[model samples]
Target chain A: MSELSTAAAVFISIGVAFDLIGGLGLIRLPDIYNRLQAATKCVTLGTCFILIGVLIQFGFTSIGVKAILCLAFILMTSPTAAHAISKGSHDFGIKLWEGSVVDKLAEDKSKE
Target chain B: MMKKMLFHFLMLFGVWLLFTWTLEIPDVIAGVIVSLILAVLLNSIFDGEVTSLLNPVKLFWAIIYIPVFFYHMMVANLDVAYRVLNPGLPIKPGIVKVKTKLKSDLGKTTLANSITLTPGTLTVDIKGEYLYIHWINVLSDNVEEATKEIVDKFEKYIVRFYG
Candidate 1:
């Protein structure tokens, strides 16, 4: 196999591994916030690596640049977006896990 | 005025280069012309000259702020990952309204986004000057301190950047 194809295979495999880790995080994590954390960070990073691989294999300059831009966009936006959705869910009043150790927000509100 | 337009065009040209794989003269020239037209059209629609490029100081600070944010995001992700996989439901979730002194709309929005990005918290609503956040752990069972942490770390930076 050519060096280029080998590089492509490596990147694709790394991306797939990240995606799997993210999926595992979603299933294994306990709450909404935790789940989103995994989904946004792991998935976004994983996809970026995968796309970067594709960009390398295909020497289309425009595609590579666009993919890099996409990676940047995801890095910046995904966590914030997930945060927004989770916050919205929380504001609507979701229950926390019973094993929770702190409720600082709740305590401070009472004093005020 | 012309230089500002030229820079905007250049940025677009860079974008165009990413779209087309060639670095030939014809492609470069075409990219420049198309980008300039786009800039002109955008300027007209916005009813003013776009001048984000005019502020060198703000631009410089943005470069500094981005890396700090990335580090914080990574740490938050790890924290959340541990909690989610912790077997027991260890989250103490609740919604609390945080009264913030940040006056600008950008400040409020930044505060909201920052809170949301952290591992255990979410920004639910911004009603007037109040920020409602839903936190997963709540740290100390103290709402005010919890809210303060959100405002201090994320909102403060955003206010400085966009406000």
Candidate 2:
């Protein structure tokens, strides 16, 4: 196998691993907020790294640029989208796990 | 006028580099013209929060911050994975309001975004210096520790950048 092909395989494998890790996070985390964190950051960063690898394999063509553009868009938008969704869920009053240390928001609001 | 034009031109130049990956004269000219048009349109529509592109020092820091964020993402991912796979619902979920020291709107936004980005926590709302976060699990019911973990890692750097 060529060096480039091997590297590409490695890149794709890493990307797939990130995606799997994200899925696993959703399953393992105690609640929704935590799950979103895994899905947004670990998965997104992993995909970005994998895409970069693919771009390197493509050797700086328009296709490579497109891959980079996709990566950039993901970086900018994913967290924002996740934030919106999580906030929406919170507004709906999704319960947090049983062990909670603080309720500062409620406390501060009452003080005001 | 010249300074404004140069600023717009540099932006266009960056776009051109991203799009075409070429430095040929035609590409540079095309980039300059397109950027000028964009600048004019932006100048007409833009209001509030103007930032300069020539600040290489700030850009250098931004470049540094991304990798740091990546590392945090990896850690969050691992933490979440362990929680999900554990047989016991050993989860402690709650919403806590933590005080934020970040001042700028952009800085706050970035901080909120990062908190939501990390696994096991979400930013529910932002009011003044306080962030309402819904945590999936409370490792030890230590809201202060959790707040420190996030604010120290994410918020501080975001303040350094956009604030």
Error of 2 at B83 (Å): 2.4
Best by lDDT: 2
Off by over 4 Å in 2: A1-4, A24-34, A93-112, B1-9, B22-30, B44-53, B139-145
**TM-score for each predicted model, relative to the true structure:** 0.68, 0.77
Q: How do the residues A26-73 of candidate 2 rate in per-residue lDDT, one tens digit apiece?
A: 677656666676677667877887898888788678878979888888
- Residue A80, model 2: lDDT of 83
Task: Please list the residue runs of candidate 1 whose C-alpha ends up more than 4 Å from where it truly belongs after superposition.
Answer: A1-18, A28-34, A48-64, A76-112, B1-10, B43-53, B99-111, B140-143
Q: Write the per-residue lDDT of candidate 2 for residues B1-163, one digit (tens) a residue.
A: 5566556657666867788878789987888788878877776454323253246766666778888877777677667666655677556666666778877776787788777766567787787887887666655435577678657777666655566
Candidate 1 chain B: 10-residue stretch with minimal lDDT: B44-53
**Tens digit of lDDT per residue, candidate 1, span A1-112?**
3466878889889777767777888887666755665676667667877988978887656667778778777766875787667656655666555555644344544588
Name the TM-score of candidate 2. 0.77
The CAPRI classification for model 2 reads as medium
lDDT of 1: 0.66
